[model samples]
Target chain A: MAPTTQTPPSLRPSPATLAITRIVLIAAAVLFLAPVYWLIVSSTKSNPDLISSNGLLFAGNNIVENYTALMSWTQGNFWRWVGNSMLYSTVAGVLGTLVSVSAGYALAKFRMPGKAGIQLAILGGLLMPIALLTVPLYIFFNGLGLTNTIWAVIIPSCVSPFGVFLGRMFVDAGVPDELLEASRLDGSGEVRTFFTLVLRLLAPAMVTIFLFIFVATWNNFLLPLMMLNSAELKPVTLGLYGMMSYFSPQYGAVLQGALLSVIPLVVLFFVLQRYWQSGLTAGAVKG
Target chain B: MSTLTRPTAPERLVTEQRAQANRRRRRREGRIGWGFFAPFAILFVLTFVIPILVSIRSSFFTEKAAGDSLYGGGGMVETFAFLDNYAQVLGNATFWEGMGRVLLFGAFQIPVMLGGALILALLLDSFIVRRVAFFRLSYFLPYAIPGVIAALVWTYIFSPGLSPINQTLGSISEWLTGLLGNNVDLTIDFFAPGTIIASMATMTTWTFMGYNMLIFLAALQAIPHDLYEAARLDGAGEFDIVRRIKVPMVGQATLLAVLLSIIGTVQLFNEPTVLAAVNPWMGNDYTPMMLAYSSMMGTTSPSGAGPASAVSISMAVIAGILAAIFALVQKRSTR
Candidate 1:
């Protein structure tokens, strides 16, 4: 059998079949990246060049112009949106990872009261289709005067039941109980053991959960749309969205902004690609 | 699981004292475990339980104005309305139509995307291509792209004047028109309301197919290597091995992919919303989620929070039911 997610070979094939499969795979990959290619090409053009130039070819070196223009659209508000997005996604990633890791470790490894109930709650949460909660959460947050505040977006995002589930699974598979027992025997506390040994063991799962939450918070539009009204509080997703009404005229700058906004995540994905792949497969293998 | 000890418990100690000590340790461990779990539990309750309880509670009630005009009321009053919200949501045709549109959209998109993903996984796992890592990474790269950027780029690409698809087809259509001695319009306007769902589906599939492939690929890799050797020893062909071994082994992952796709796509917002942002023809009620949003967002209306909450609840219930049914069918089929 093939190693599931890994690319190491399995079955031998005839030359014809190999050639056909290779062609098909290459064609598919090119087709997949075609839009991103279009965006990259288009982002370098000014508005006039965008109209005149070939859709898939660079027209001029207008990257700086487009970047500055997009940033200056609302008096450098684009920078604020990017900063807000980074802050929310990063903070949410850290907080979500911490809660998920600890909760997962506890549920997976500890002798505890109400474990099943907590499990049930998280499972129930998994079914709730989190986006639906935005309206009610908006209501509650508004009642508490949290609307138009940063907490409106970050607070609701702080918990991801799926992360909790994955974390539990990770703890069960990755961490050995014997090691915890040894730590206790060596006079290490639960907090110390978790921070020292369990944290190291769960690095992959931590990255997995962090990336998931980070992308989610970065990608989120509705929560911010509902909770936030001020321009300064907007994350990049909603900020670009708010700028899209005049999209046809500002198409170049808007496209540039969108692509630039997404680059951080792409870079993050590249850096953490190895761990996330393994962590994800761990879920599959264990399941 | 025995702990290494500096010294054994004194034999002179009474059994009760030792038992009590053991109980205290277990209790202390329980406290620590509870401590570890405290943050999630509190957050889950605040963000999950309270929202759910209050939403459900609020669904049975609505806010009414104190006067004849909804706007003129000095103070809005919250009143028990029984299942009025649920009934209204059920009676709302546009909302149901939006629901139907999303369901119909998912019906075709989910299967085709998953099929593509599975095939890609199988091909990658088989190593028919030498650059397995390169191809895998290429397919998976789109997963990192934000859905908004994907939608915007695709929307731009699919728009009539900006679209290369139209330009390419325009040339072809001119040739066909000349060949046929009449006008032959092969150029497609991909942003029209009629084709918005298909456009949405394309962007969605483009963004997600790789993610699904990763899931399937991961499952494909987990199949035991011994099983393939045994099948080969029994004279099974490559095709036979894939069908009889690889596909069967990854059924759980397939089910998972399907379920996740269902849950995720059922709440479809970003693509349609982005498309609608440019193409107003798609309207605010393009999907159930959109309808829920649009309901709460009018200047003259009384916030429409009641109706919006109802729609949100309805979408959640429908998605839950679909997911449950899918899980059950998979369970049954596997058994």
Candidate 2:
């Protein structure tokens, strides 16, 4: 909701209170941005310069060196990890969005037996803490001889019940019953109707769901840690963590890698703020 | 006799036609619905249901070191050890200690974070704050940063060698010592075991406070403007308006945020796990999830899976119980 342009005269806050609010807000913003500021600043400095100089201020002109060294570290494996992360998240996001949205549309529009039970199960799955699933999933994948492969990460991530829940809400809100009925009355098959009629209306919801799933999979560390082993298969998070364990002397490289890992998501987040915000509130309110 | 008991022939014919058409449509709808639902159902079963079942089943079994199997020189055998792993997990001091630590963390962190979020949301929703969009984005920027990176960034800030925080504290302590003419260590050791929890809590707050604030803001926006207008007309002050109207109006959302926080706190892993790399006090068994992870990874036990399953199941139970309790309380309050 947009804020009203003009406040009623009677409801206007006093100048002193307004000033205090502004000051508090600005202080909080600075506190929130402080670490990010430090991150960006430190990524530009050399390891020695990082320790010797003021951390809050810009000091060294070693951005190129730091990034070059970061890229070349670990036999240039950082770039590979970034590639693997991008692949896994993208595949999972697209495929998961498709499955969840289709199911959600069906559940919302079609009359089916056991519909209530299915919806309830989705809700329960949403509430279940995924951290608890890591161990069993590891065991399961280990049994399947799939633990070290990217499939182990992508497969489980593709089944987000929250996405399904969001999909149902989006469909219910975005798609009208009359449109589906009209398509059906025209003798269009269920699949065709969905593809031709409902899919366009569902684009915004799809983007929202896709972005959410992408971010979740992109940020996922525990699953990859539990499932993958080879250095080449590691995502950015686990890759950075592995580096952090032994790269104490080269804090510059680690900071650079961390900053690099965060930059893509931050850019995407700002670009898709509207969809992401609505998606977040949608789940919280409905689920 | 049949004709007398039944409806007229025309009516009977119409009823039969309608029933037949309805059945055909119902069957078609069912087919399409099931067809569409198949993919998700199959994957959900494979990933979620199967793992949960396997965990539940394995939680009741204990791994025994068996002699050479047909294909292997040594193999671990799982025997039906009902309640044994559960007993071990429940009886372990470290497990309870981790649980206690998390409970304490939640108790302190939830209030401060949620309270801060509520206040911020109120301030933004009020007429006093301008440039709401920029402020909202700035506040929520941390949430976009992954938990792993967030921890890493904060580790830089907490590092004594690299942190501006420590540098600032160092000068402040030095100034204090000079003024008092006595040696006083006033600088905060963020990595110290005693302060690690608070430090971690602060990081957690930093990451989640804005996210929660957005939820509260959404709820606040949903409140009808007329209610606020009415309150203002009745000579209600800003504090009174917030207290009397906004808070109660957002009760459901507040409860939802609280419940989600409870579930989230119970499963706290990523932040502490990342921070443990920099801080020695945060051991492998720092939280229940970590303990379970360490156990599952065979760091804590020779037969790790059984005990790890028990630990995970226990965590799930605790989360479910807490969620149920919150739901009950919220229902009661509403009633």
Candidate 3:
């Protein structure tokens, strides 16, 4: 690490190379940020301004009116949708993280039977796209009388096979077996040893797992759409989709609402950008 | 007092025995492992396994609606329609056309998406790029937005009345129409059938390019830095470094992304579904999954729950087969 850290001093590029690299970087940045820029600009504009003005340019005067009209557009249903999204994301994120972390710890630390079966199941779940399961999940939930509630959203999310799989790999690699044995020898109970001692060391992995689950659950649409019938219970994705259906004639308002719905996700991404990157990279490599 | 303090071997043995019993108790406490995995097992089986079985069963049986109210009354599930639904799906020209469209979409999309991602990843990994963290995060921002929201945002951009491009084209069209009076060109309509794939592709590329880019970038970062230094010393250019080193190193990541993209492409639902709501041309049955949904729950008439299930099962099977083939190929290549 020390030797590699010193190599950056000698690594310098010529002016021509720097110019080309800068152009590439700037272009890439623009390509990525164009939709977001459109989103922000469209959000502040009213129906007329959205139609007339340049999408990329800012004529940021309609912010207040847009917010007011958006709030009242569906009789205060938008805020209710936001609340439902929060409830679903928060519950699913926390529970999913817990299940993943604990199961990971067990699989990493123990000599339990059927570990292979569980691990293979997780792999299968990871490989199987959630779309294939959505219909089946709906039918299953319907049979069990679990459809149309926050529990239906939260329940299926709790078994994120990818999370558990990633968490297990993180634990096995990051937390040493000797340390666990030492904790056991010191007369600490397994759960206590895990939560109080091992958890501190597992912070990075935990953060990564939490952010991934949070983002995934926040972006979840199919399951929620299939399960929830009540508009009030719909998460923001389903809610936004419903609004888009009605906003066919009012393209400007649809754009504004679409942009509004993304604010939370943008905030989340910015806050956890580092964790998200490292976690994603790690998962890809291991995968 | 000294004699009492110097006590016995039996006392030490008794304490040692107690400690062993305590160790035994700790060993027994391992059953709490079940407590951890119990919830996962129950939910996994209930949600994933059972539904798949039910779907498979439903795929074979034809639901004959006997009563006046087709839904409320007696619907019978009968024996094997032996490849009938598959035959229908194959014979149904719309299903084949949708499949062809997605194939074209996949062809156009996979290359553009993967290419853009590869370029971005390579550039970001270069030493010349400033603020590596900022570049990485910015590129990945689109994926953070919900698919539904992403589609909605793109829809607004593509809207005829509000779109900037539409206005630009409208002005050009007005000039041309004035010059050539009453013989106006029809190319101004942005959602024309010829252009719908491009529209949908643009939206999809925006949403997922960053995600794939990040995966590639991560793979790029994992490559040994010394490889680049070695190439530079050998007078290799930047392009050479990317071509020879970065791409080869991240082959597995690329392969994984391909498999994932293919699976997602087959399940194409949200983009077309949302777009169809806006434009009549991009109808409800714009894709196979959409076809299934419309068949099962269309406002027209509820026809063929059995066939819908069959189509769905067929999709699942094809996806499964492709996934298996990819997995097998990946395993072999990696080995």
Candidate 4:
């Protein structure tokens, strides 16, 4: 690995090279940030301003009015959709993290029957796109009268094979076998030791997995679009998409809704940036 | 402690007891291991395995009547129509056209996006750049936004009424016409059928370029500094070092990103679906996943679950095959 802590004085680029590099990077940054700039700027504008004014330019200070109108646009249904999204994402994240982490830890630290088969299954599930399962899942949930309910989304989402794969990798990297042996020697049962000792050690992985699942469930559109028919049960993605589909002059509301849906996640990303970065790097580099 | 110094008989007895306890512990650990695996295993089977089985089974059986269910009910019975749905889905021109469109989109978008990401990553990894952290975060920020929101934001940006792009192009076209004294139209309608794929590609590249960049960046970060020093001692330039050292070192990461993009391209749904709202030409069935979705819901066709299963299964097969081929190629290259 590159010695990131210290750089040799001799290896530093010339002043002109550094200046050129900075210029290029700044240009790239502007390109990346343009849409985000537009999203925030356009959300604050009125409908006429949005249509007539430059998209890159901020036109009016209608943030409060636009947000209020967005919240009250569908008879206070936007907030309900937000709440539903929170509930589903939270439940699925927590439950899915638990299931995946435990399974991953076991697969990493223990010897069990049919372990190879189980590992293969995890790999298969990870590779299989969720789109293939959506149709039958809809039918299965519909048959059980579970469609239009939060469980339809939450139940299927909780079975994240990628989460399990990541959990296993995290366990292998973070947890030591000697520690497990010590815990076992101290008469700690497997479940008890996991809760008191292993869980703490795996906290970073748990947080990453939780946030990953949370964001996935929050951003999910197709599953909820297919599973839930009622507006009350809709997540912000589907709800906002529905709003945008209409020809009504609710572009401002839709933009506000889009901004509102993104804020929590962006906040989460900033706050938990370290864990997310590690998790992502682990997946890409280690796996 | 005494057993260590004790006579053979007592030491033997203690050793036997310890061995028995070890056996007991091993048994218990095995039981607990299965217990730990149970929840995920059950859910995995229920959600993934069962649905796949159901999809495969239904793919072979067409609905004989309108009200027929996969599960026998409603006084409706399904006939064994083996390979019929598969034949329909495979033979369908629209399916092939959609597949071709997606392949073309993937072919154009993946290289540009991944290549752009690689360049950015390489540039950031260079010693010339400072504040690498800020640049990385800025690039990655777009990925945090939901695909739906990303699509929606871009939809506004692509709109002729609100878009700087269209307005700029319109003026440029007028300028060209005036300068040449000939009628020339440089303005391109992004929503038009001929250009929608490129528009969609732009949105996708915007959403995912950062993500792929981060992967490449991570891979680049793992390269040893000694190699760069050696290359520098040999008087290699930055581009030479990147081509000879950094890119070769990050081959696996690049392959992983490409494979992931391949899967993602096949499951292209959200952007096109959202864009279809504004661009009537880019209909719901513009992509394979969308076709499968519309077919599954009977939104675009009356074929019901059988054809939908076939479409989905076909998509899954194609994805599986592409992934397998990539993996095989990667393996061979690494060897």
Q: Report the alpha-carbon TM-score of model 3 versus the true structure.
A: 0.87
Q: Which stretches of candidate 1 lie over 4 Å from their true place?
A: A1-11, A246-248, B1-19, B67-73, B178-180, B299-303
Residue range with the least summed lDDT across 10 consecutive positions in model 4 chain A: A1-10
Worst 10 contiguous positions by lDDT, candidate 1 chain A: A1-10
* DockQ-based CAPRI category assigned to the predicted complex of candidate 3: acceptable
Q: Model 2, clash count?
A: 0
lDDT (10s digit) by residue, model 2, range A1-287: 43446776766778899899999899999999989989988888887788888888888688888777777776689888888988999999999999999999888888999998998898888888888888999887888898999899999989989888888899999999998888889999888988888889999899999998898899888899999999999999898888876665477778889988888889998999999778867854653
Model 4: per-residue lDDT, tens digit, A122-145? 877766787668988876777678
Those runs of model 3 whose alpha carbons end farther than 4 Å from true positions after fitting are A1-14, A247-249, B1-35, B66-83, B168-188, B232-237, B298-305, B324-335
| Model 3 lDDT tens row, A197-239 | 7678888888888887877888887778778899788888888
How much does candidate 1 score in TM-score?
0.93
lDDT top scorer: 2
Name the better of 2 and 3 by lDDT.
2
Error of 4 at A164 (Å): 1.6
Per-residue C-alpha lDDT of model 2 across residues B1-335, encoded as one tens digit per residue: 87778889898999999999999989998989999999999999989988888889988998776766555457778899899999998999888999998999999999999999999999998876779999899999998888888888787778887878878878888899999999877678788878878888999999999998888888788778888778878899889999999988778788878888998898889878878887766789999999999998888762477899999999999988988988998899778
Stretches of model 2 off by over 4 angstroms after superposition: A1-5, B1-6, B68-73
Indicate whether candidate 2 or candidate 3 has the larger DockQ.
2
